[model samples]
Target: MKSQMLPTIFIMTLALSVCGVYSGKVLVFPIDGSHWINMNILIKELYSRGHTVTVFRSSGSWYIKESSPHYNSITVEDVAGGFDEDFLKMLISRIIQIQADGKSSWKRLQVEWELMKLGPVMTQMEINVLAKLLDDHKLMQSLRDAKYDLVLADPVGASGGIIAHYLNLPLVFNVRWTVHSEGHFAIAPSPMSYVPMPMFELADKMSFLERVSNVFFFAFYEFQAQFLIRPLWATFTNKYFGPDVDYFQLIQGADIWLMRVDFVFEFPRPTMPNVVYMGGFQCKPAKPLPQDLEDFVQSSGEHGVVIMSLGTLVSELPRRVVEEMAAAFAQLPQKVIMRYTGEKPSTLGNNTLLVEWLPQNDLLGHSKTRAFVAHGGTNGVQEAIYHGVPILGVPLMFDQPDNLSRMRAKGAAKVMDIFSVNRDTFLQALQEVLHEPFYRENMQRLSRLHRDQPMQPLDRALFWIEFVMRNKGAAHLRTESYKMPWYSYHSVDVILFLLAVLATFMASFVFGIKFLCTKVCCKHKSKLE
Candidate 1:
């Protein structure tokens, strides 16, 4: 049976590849976030093939000008300058900091920020971005005229979905699995029983207490988004999507959610067919390391080198953190290449090299690189996995802990809490991953699985993208469970029905017992008489 399946699958794949250029006009509307890195890969591949790809992005977004006949871009003037990229980073930082402080005043402030300031400001930002896309009447008409096959929607925000629906285009989502929100969960199967919410960073198998907390985690998430955030955003959303449309409903519009995750790392969870796993699609062939970096690693002798980075979102860390990190590296025999964006630390050891930015993937791919010590971001973690480098994860906030947890679970990494980090603990973590053989072996095993796929991640992504195009967004693959209400999804009605029947049977049995007792007592009285 397995042998037959392989031959048949190969035949079908061949058919898909040679299906005679069912080329498409794909509209790419990637959100201006960490998502852009992968989208850049997707765009390039689509154009490299025969497909006509057009992107609605800002002026300064990473793209070559008129790169090819098939490649094109449309820059929205207002979107280019309107949204403040730093504002979001600052807001998230402030929120996380306040949550850490846990003062009554801070709690009140967080509430006010979320209820009054955060929602309104974020809503206006989305409004500005989308309005700019639609504001030009002529541009809107031209987009209508182009007859796009599908809209590649970023699953993070509502603007992309709104635009796609307005244009009557089928929407396919490229999602990050670790997003773990009420809105994103709606895209596919996310049973509250086992699927750990990204916010909690709990393992797939939870303790009784953890499960209890997980339930509340979900409840609050759903409550906050549906009740608090939606009302505020809806005013702006309704203005654009028309008065009748529900803001929360926009997330459900995705015909497919191409999640950036693999089951090998994540815990086993139920997923529907349309929730396609296209994880590590961003793993590309590593370019050669710069000569200077190569020379630096070569100077490490037999100790090799370890790379450190906190990724873009949390590049500028606290001074103490940097000081401790430097102290930790100073103790290690291995040389370190630390990528930091803020002011360079003064505690520089001769073995430590600090750069504002580094080619992380290139460094990880290097043969002598011993370990990675950094903020546990999905991108960085995936890159490390691809390069077979073990990690010393310094998890800060959001999905970082969860990403780190997965790495730790895989036996390829160890997690040190950023909040509770000390020189002793930090240095030990670095040493353990560097010195251990199992860490390297486990990572190598994962790397083999990642690369050993029948087709590469990029090819698979392209195939699915074109498949969606060819199959009109592949609506047939969508699960009916998406359309189900919360009650129906969990089968509340079925439970109620069974409970009612059990109650009826119990009542009848009690009545029968009482009648038999009465008959026996009457017979006893007759015998006495």
Candidate 2:
């Protein structure tokens, strides 16, 4: 009876606290495909908590039309054509082509940066699609009539900002990338002392060379954003929002920023009032695995199971690498369930099970699951950490190297370069992570920290969302530093002014001393004569 009464009382109290503060009409614009799940969890939770939610997203997004009564998903095609699909197909092709040419990680990094240099081209493509949406007379009318409480947008692309401006709504950015430069610039101080740039794969601590690379990469990011791509974003903004609007200034209109990063998995850094961390925010209880998968895991005996997946970004690994991993799995005692989108490279070993896709969270949650082999994507890494599963990270591109570096630094994972993957090396990595107690212990610690938040991420997000609605965009939360120019915000201008003053004073004193010394010497000479 006491247990029953306690839960009942808790529920009632929670309900009362959320009455007016948790419900509002929210417009969500998140990146489609793999990144969608991050915000999808928040959206579902919001709807369950009685918020009227509208999502402007891709047609192929996970959210279907019949998912909920409180939600309305506006497909990108209803306004613009099916550009998301086209973009993703192009992206995949480019990645595959680059992988073919890039024989080493350094070469791959250069290829990725080369793609980043095509920012203007990408920006123009986004602006073209979004412009069509804005020009849709009926869609614009409906959006204006909706009287949305707030706009939620992903900062990866410029379309969200343009849409938010067109609707005359307050904007909030949801960043899937842990170290998004633009998102960091929008909300608060991202000092180089702690903040890392994405272009260079850097961790929190840096040697002299790493720091030099960090600064250089930051200059590169600035070049892409300001000099190379700024003109494209500027043209779009001017064409739509008027010539008076500067892209940088327009981007600063974001009221709040929610980053899917936490101190547990990342290096601890200072964050602003408007900046919120939601790492492992997408983690939820796993549903039951299929009977087939369950049987496979249970059949592994006392050796446990290992899950290997490269995530959605990589459709398939190179056939040679796939065959090598398969051979390594054959030599292991543990049963492995791997996600493979391509044909089997070689005859499958009795210890391995190949599936097109598996319920990743469900597999991770299983007690029999002892290890993970992945490409070190943030979501995959976070999920592995959430489940307390040690990982053998085979990083390929983007933030994968940095994520794996941090994982290795934290003692939760081992990293093997994709280029260096042979049967011997792969098997050695697997043996180390599975047999080592330190790796499992570190993973367990990470899991505990990720879940030990004061309030759940969903509730925190809802609280801020409704807080913005109730306060008419929560302008109070915006830091004053957002208004400061780059030089003033970083104190570069003040430092220069102080240096100039000191130089002037020193010059004046030196002149005075020289003049007095000459006069004294002349007077002494005259007296001697």
Candidate 3:
């Protein structure tokens, strides 16, 4: 009997260990491309912790797969006019053409105008997809029946918040950009004075002219959000969620904001209680490179290896630009690993290896890596900071320039203008980053600071996510400021009311003084008579 009891106890213990004490169902709605990459990391972690995860992706999604061991997938069908690879490539090509035309201010304005046009197109496409998902009665019913503990979303697309509100589930945002602007601009007290607008490439410590441009860019984004993006989302939310529902307010009402930024990368700014900085959460210690790659890297000897990747979307550049880049790489003593899919440049050197894709993090982590040549995406910048590798940035478009600007301001990077960069300029920039001690020193300092946290960024993000699920919602951490009207939230109405009271008091005091003078004069006149 004692032996039988021991076996039963062993079985119970094993079961408990495999399936943890608590588990919650999570529903993830993520944007595709690089954003999905970030979200997928969290989903895997959630699965490892004994929780069930479901991911929502469109049928035409480029990066997201239908099946994964980490989580189940929910594929929405017939997402028309979606932002696909071909479409993105065309847009990128057009932008590159415009930039390559010349570096005149007019050319710059044309680029800005072109980006502004994209605002309406992207917003409309997102709303159309949201409508299709919400209108599907069967899908809606299935989601409602699932009884998810919380809804995690990237608020770049508005459906996540709207659907979460519809299901009456707790909402958590893994965010950097909301549809309106940067996540902080939507929820925090962002003063344009110090907080530089995104994409303008201005630093926190701005000169007078820089601040003017900052405010101008702020207004430009505000106009796009108010006049372009908001109307479409508002129309959709009115139809599905009701006329009373405001999508912007729904976004602001989220339980937690796992901000994809930290002070080490972003400028210091005012933030809220619910805003958790998980900058570099997706980064980890670099693993060993594959054998072939390792052999090549080891062959770099004293000079070490240099890596170049232009993020996910913009893989290839114009042939002329590609040739110039190749020529520049040919001159470097350092071994070059470039992720390119374009035609091989005639100037390509034996030292440079052009692969379709390389393990970016692993290469950066290698001790042989001396510097990185990259298109400054958020993920790449954070990874470089994590690995303590300096950068020579060739920013292509949209937030890439701004991302590089921050690194340059921090003394860890040197940025080049894609429009004007020829072989000579490109070669000069790379040599500076490679030879300079300060660039390496500065980036290593940032890496030290980033790694010296009590909890890893990923762990902190996971803890807050679990905390929200356990408590049903993190209402205690979230502020009720979103409910207030714009005037009330800014205290404009209160200021007006105080001004009215002051005016009334001053008028009454003046009247009292006039009345006293009249009475005294009348008494004196009567005495004289």
Candidate 4:
């Protein structure tokens, strides 16, 4: 009896040790500060659940690397060094070129459009290069040596996905936007519009002309990707590393895709098994507002305050636009805090304070804050809606314009053009937004809808992650899509075949009737004679 008891105790001790070892390694890749915040929240949640997490990020990212003894940071180089200057010049030139060419320069215009679309893809490629660089720097080698059980990555960072692919670890792709009906994923509202495209908005609902236009669009992207972007990535990889690498393969192998959009913000649609919506995961009440911000809000009193931020990507606004905004804010009765990274414009009035950085979530959560002036970034838009704050969106590019348009259409927000924005227009928009109770009501309604979930978004996301891990790839969830060819998938060949068969049948029937009529006419003529 004593020997049997000793054996059971030893087995229990071994099991505990194995569980502890399994919980000690999770590798995360965060490309930007927002991603850092998001991943940090997730890591903290996992840590509380008894899992260890390490983050790999660029040095420029704002997350405090040394804060936690458990947290380890691996730095990557800034490949886009001084790129802001070049990017600004290029943007101006492209805008001018688009205006000058109009519809006449279709080919060149298409090229320019493709280049714009390729922005995110190119950024990912650069990240992939950076990942390989990190690999050489001994970070990836250490991770491999450590034998991490999972590799969680932001979709924007190529290294995370690439390393996961190479290491044959479970890979989770985190998306920060809504998924589209066309199977393409959008990170934010396509600077095109805001009201989410419903599931009914599929290719079948389009007119014949619209379908044709879509064909052309798809063809253009395919051409650009195959000829330009793919080649560029291949060349970079080959030159940097050796000939053993396959650039395209790295993109195809994510085990699971996680999205940061909620059903309230986006329409419900049939999604691939691997795609999971995890939006609003990091949206929780944080610490109190800074003393200075608190004092400023108190100073505003009954009139309340408006918080403005254009997001990190477009931190530097055009000087003219800034001046116009300053003039507009000067007339507004509400106190305004604008987050601007550039030099403080001399034209800003007493009502407006230009700060280099402000805690956005804290500001939004403030009782005195009534409205948001934003770029309609996914995070910003969601945060505004979550906090029940009305918005005035000055969308600049990509999904921002689309997002703002949707918000405006929903009567929850107003849209202002970035290029031609001025004092009068800004003032009127502000007045309408501040005075209108409907906007706040609508925002609150959305906030309620967003929160009416069966499970917290973070929990749901984590469950899916563990589900995939436990199920050994979650193959049961995958659509039979991998089995079909492109033509079959689109049903183009089926349509073409049916059209051919119908055409043949019609031609044969028409010819047979014509021959019969001719014979009857001859017989009738002979009988008459």
Name the 10 consecutive residues with the lowest summed lDDT in model 1: 177-186
Model 4 ranges off by over 4 Å: 1-24, 57-70, 75-144, 177-219, 232-253, 480-483, 493-529
Residue pairs of candidate 3 with colliding backbone atoms? none
Top candidate by lDDT = 3
Per-candidate clash tally: 0, 0, 0, 15
Model 2 regions more than 4 Å off: 1-22, 58-70, 76-83, 100-106, 178-182, 514-529
Best-to-worst TM-score order: 3, 2, 1, 4
Per-prediction TM-score to the true structure, in the order listed = 0.84, 0.89, 0.95, 0.74
Task: Identify the candidate with maximal TM-score.
Answer: 3
- Give lDDT: candidate 3, residue 25: 97
Candidate with more favorable, higher TM-score: 1 or 3: 3
Off by over 4 Å in 3: 1-20
7-115 per-residue lDDT for model 3 (tens digits) = 8999999998867657999999998888999999999999998899999888888889998999999988756668777777888989988988647789879999998
* Candidate 1 per-residue lDDT over residues 1-529, each given as its tens digit: 9988999999999988878678799988776667777777788788878788887776544333424464577876555344446665776677556544333555644644553456545566666777777778899999999999989867666766777888888887777731126234776567667888774568888888998988887887667677656776678766776777765565675777777887766777777677777778887667888899889999999999989998776657666767777888888889999988877777668899999889998898888899998788888998998889998888766567778888787888888766556678888888788888989999999888887777776777778888888877777777656456778888898899889999999999999999999999999999999
Q: What lDDT score is found at residue 476 in candidate 2? A: 74
Q: How many angstroms is residue 255 displaced in model 1 relative to the true structure, after the best TM-score fit?
A: 2.1
**How does each model score on lDDT?**
0.75, 0.76, 0.90, 0.68
lDDT of 2 by residue, 273-335 (tens): 777777777776777889988989999999999999988756776677788889999999999
